[model samples]
Target: MNNPDSLTNHFLIAMPNLADENFARSVTLICEHSEEGCMGIVINRLTDLHLCDIFDQLGITPDKASHANDVVYLGGPVQSNRGFVLHEPLGKWESTLSVTDRFGVSTSRDILEAIAENRGPEKFIVALGYAGWGVGQLEREITENSWLSGPANQDIIFNLPLEQRWKAAAQLVGVDLTTLSSEAGHA
Candidate 1:
């Protein structure tokens, strides 16, 4: 569960000036946020791997309905070897973190098995790793203008082309990322 004011179900848009290689111009979906910590999945960066490759690793045979060729994403820098499935409709799964009534994240093998059989959630994206911040860390970075937070938009996550996501997420909050100066200065 998240606090009412928490960023749990929001999009974390990295400001243009954020030069970190893993997060530059990235859009992350905050899945779990509370006094304990914050965890998110970066939606805009793609890895060279595909879903079938992962199935092979897990020894799950892909069925015809399995969209095994779909590209996988680099969710974040943490747990880079583990797989996560970010899906809509919040279906019942063995191990799922319900981000919201409509969205959930599943790390259990059962969801992956269902996906391999094409019996998984209708809308989903597979990701490896996840972005994480310790207690109060994300807030401090946000105060420093490293990110812009806004309500999560499903279209951007499951529909839009990758190149357009960064701008689209920021646009949802009426922040024209293009107009912001990239230079950071502190008084």
Candidate 2:
């Protein structure tokens, strides 16, 4: 059994052989875990949309004085229409969920408003949708060697350029993603 506290605020880095499209070379942050399986976000996939576009659709105006470009990310497969923000620690919103000491997840418009006003967390990546697992599903994957869990790094999660995050996260476990083999072997 994984220690409840230990899995909290950790990254589940997919192994070289993970074949699932949703998780191949993916870096998932375990946010909320309970008897109800696990829920997290893929921190590295960037979407074509921008944060400002989302705000515009919601009729929220970003602060003109702030450098108001919000980084949009591909959160996961579930609830793709909803927005989730994985951000650096800062001004807390009522719905902010602390993933770790350095990161948190907020799904509230109030937090979005703060972000638009430049009064939100210092660093943030806005994601659409979220990845979810059924009870024991994640554990089954881990047992099958589909992932290698590691401590979450804020630099990789919040600070690194999106293009470099996947490689950087894979490097945390000393594996070069380019050299990885997607085929599962049974020798």
Candidate 3:
């Protein structure tokens, strides 16, 4: 079993039994990784806030009302006050983290402006925070089977609806999450 790249730009779908308050049933997209630790965003955790809510706070009226329903997500337990966008590469920005060949992260405000203007990346999800692990903490969790990792499917990341992402990612690995049990001590 080879160790997964800390910066693999993939998704970690929590197993059904993952009761951790921070990541249960969450889908995290790895952003940056090194021997020191790892950082990522939870793609499926929708927040009570919406893009319009942020736009209002910024004094920017959206060009159209179509974005009114956009839901901001609680990306992770870290940096809950910050905003980050994990999106498809549509237009370049001053700050962007290429998680994988297909996924990228842009934290700069310009991207958000573009989104408010109705001209942002083709596909994106707005998140309020991000998930992080210190040094070997992630490796320990994986060894303990708290999560099931796999290559990210672009469609699942961008196209699938929120509630379905977990099962969709699980299916990518050919396991039915519903059949997964939380008992780790079982043989």
Best candidate (score: TM-score): 1
lDDT of 3: 0.83
lDDT of 3 by residue, 83-151 (tens): 898888735787888776566888888988888887888889889989999988888899899888887
Residue 77 CA displacement from its true place in model 1, Å: 0.3
lDDT of 1 by residue, 1-187 (tens): 3377799999999998999999999999999998899999999999999999999999999998788999999999999999999998899999899988898999999988888888889899999999999999999999999999999999999999999999999999999998999777789
lDDT of 2: 0.80
User: Over all chains combined, what TM-score does candidate 2 have?
Assistant: 0.87
Local distance difference test, candidate 1: 0.94
Superposition-based RMSD of candidate 3 using all C-alpha atoms, in angstroms? 2.6
- How do all the candidates rank in terms of TM-score, highest first? 1, 3, 2
lDDT of 2 by residue, 148-185 (tens): 77767888887777667767876887877788666667
Better lDDT candidate (1, 3)? 1
* TM-scores for every candidate against the unseen true structure: 0.96, 0.87, 0.91
lDDT of each: 0.94, 0.80, 0.83
Higher-scoring candidate on TM-score, 1 or 3: 1
- Descending-lDDT candidate ranking: 1, 3, 2
Residue 60 lDDT, candidate 3, scale 0-100:
75
Stretches of candidate 1 exceeding 4 Å from the true structure: 184-187
RMSD of each: 1.4, 2.5, 2.6
